[model samples]
Target: MKVGVKDLWAGGILIFLALLGLFINGGLLGIGLESHALGTARRMGPGYMPMLVFWLQLGLGCLVVFNAFSNGPDPLERWTKLDLTTLAISVSSGVILWRVMEAIGLNNNYIQVGAPCFVAMAVLAISPAWRPLGLVLASFAIFGLLLEPLGLILALVGLCVVSALADRDHNPVSVIGMTVSLCIICWFVFIYELDIRVPLWPTIF
Candidate 1:
């Protein structure tokens, strides 16, 4: 039996996520789960469903790992030194640029957000095949940073815009439509239905 590289990476990531979820929910270490009651299946608490889901994910991840080890004739993907160098430079430069901009008083929303995205895209552009990866990474990073300050809708818009850059043949109209649709769905699910206390618009405005 030969190890499958793809399966190994997938299973490893899944297992890590499952373990992270369990750790957070279980309140291990100094992390407190706070009022997350674990009610029965009939009357589920916030923790109940998440705990069950993580357990199931853990089981599935274990099965995937076993299959990875038991599978045959799977070749590993090649990652060149250039890829690692590009990633390192992009991340470090973005961080440095962000701090410098803040210190130099050029830290408006446009500069704060645009600098990182531009650096990621430019650095990864050297490897044209991996441009999508760059866009996705930058999108998520920016979204996380912007969520609290800029709010959910703006963060989603930023995410969609940056990620959409990956598709060269993408239409601007379709992109706008998709962004609007995503914002609506997220507002419905996370803000309205789930009642999460995240702001929809920028807090300052």
Candidate 2:
């Protein structure tokens, strides 16, 4: 079967993600797995999650390639000037943000989060379908900003609420109920079960 641009693009992206995951897992990103304390059960290795994710990505990429060869050609979607502009803006913004964050310091979580959210919102503001993604990014940025001062529960609640807003069909009551339930579950898993040192409630709360 003839390969189409969409297939090529999809395959390339999956392969890229797989490689990036491997790079991260291999400790080429400067944060080695050796730095993390290994639990008695060997479940706490720093590379464990990265390795799993990368392997999954690699598997999916292989599947994509196999499908590309086995299936019929896909129709190519034409990109308009607006699409090109959006792509350019998104890519440039991400690149610039990465460089700036690296030059300054990655320790600044606010900048790390805010820059990408700004880029997403700015680039996709014209598209209604993409507004949900923008909203999710914005919510994550806010979560990162509030994580320290507001504490984990509050930050999580804020994230859930704002992210839920992304879905136009979402009901506020259900959103709130789910958020509270999730917060409780997180508290039990991360705090009570794992005994992580982070605060559950805000200082003022």
Candidate 3:
């Protein structure tokens, strides 16, 4: 079977990622994870996630190569240049927001700084018809900002509401129900089951 350029390109990228992951996990050149650091599976060490990711990448790359050989060649889609203006605006806005947050002594979390900029860029760059992305970004930004101050439940609810706005055919009742249910489940799983350290409610509330 004839191989397509698209398949080859994808396969090459996957293979490169797989090798890079492996290199990082294998501690080659004395720069990657050390053997001693990779503890048992039950008590996962620093290298566990990297090893898992690399192995998955390797497997996917192999599958892509096999599919390329098994399938016949097809027409490649035309590649379009990325909108540099959108990228520039998004990056600059994110940087500015981060700096402002730092100056204001708001928690310097990366998500809190980046989310608003992402929403702004999405709203400005994309067609107005697809405003849901902007809504989602805004929701995420709000969630990030409120997560610590308002606590998880309130922040998550706010996230759900704003993100639900992205769907043109959204049902408010369903969105609220789902958001509440998800927040409860997340609170239970992350806080109780996983024993994660996060505030359930604000100190003032």
Candidate 4:
């Protein structure tokens, strides 16, 4: 039943997801005991957040169901319409990227640098009208080149330039600045505060 402002479908689905999260926390389906809000007792477990989440999802789900039934027909699009062509392209492209990289002898688990290159190349080859192919390729290339010399943060900044070039209206300057600023902030947080290494890839300085 559709009741409230937007949609019961979306609301109900969200509520269901929350309930699922709750179930995982609840240890209902052969999971371990987790923390509950009251005070983290014996059977309850470690983290209390999940119990609260379960109650929230159940409550919201009920509310959503009630609203859905009370509401009239939606004035807007009710459900998401699938884009078959785009979906097909996306799936096929991921497979194509894997195959191409393996063929090129760039077989790494992450395949960080080359994977995006292959994907971009494949997309451009198949869909010439995409128009940002050149920029996309240039961006990844520049990023790889800068990755070692400038460090992860600076290289990311360089890549953002390439990203900006992909779209005419994208402001590269602002993006670069933002990227650098975020990196510094994240670096401080991850390094100083959390004591975590920032680099999953090569750590340049």
- My TM-score estimates for the predictions, one after another, are 0.60, 0.63, 0.54, 0.41
For model 2, residues 30-63, the per-residue Cα lDDT tens digits are 4533443334322445565566667787788877
- How well does candidate 4 match the true structure in TM-score terms? 0.41
TM-score leader: 2
Better of 1 and 4 by lDDT: 1
Per-residue lDDT of candidate 3, residues 1-205 (tens digit): 5886667667778988878877767744445544526665555566765777777887888788778875758556642334445455556776777677777776656665655565564544453433555667777678776788788999899889878878869999999899989898988877877655667889797
Two-way TM-score contest, 1 vs 3, winner: 1
Clashes within 3 Å, all models in order: 0, 0, 1, 6
Runs off by more than 4 Å, candidate 3? 1-88, 100-126
**What is the overall TM-score of model 2 with all chains considered together?**
0.63
Please provide, for model 4 over 122-147, each residue's C-alpha lDDT reduced to its tens digit, 9 standing for 90 to 100. Answer: 34434334436545765676666665
TM-score of predicted model 1?
A: 0.60
At residue 128, what lDDT does model 1 achieve? 59
Q: Rate residue 167 of model 1 by lDDT.
A: 82
Worst 10 residues of 1 by lDDT: 27-36
Tell me the lDDT of model 1 at 30.
29
Candidate number with the higher lDDT (1 or 2): 1
Model 1 CA deviation exceeding 4 Å by range: 1-3, 24-74, 94-126, 167-174
In angstroms, the error of model 2 at 123 is 3.9
Deviating ranges (above 4 Å) for candidate 4: 1-83, 99-108, 112-151, 158-168, 199-205
User: Which pairs in model 1 have colliding backbones?
Assistant: none
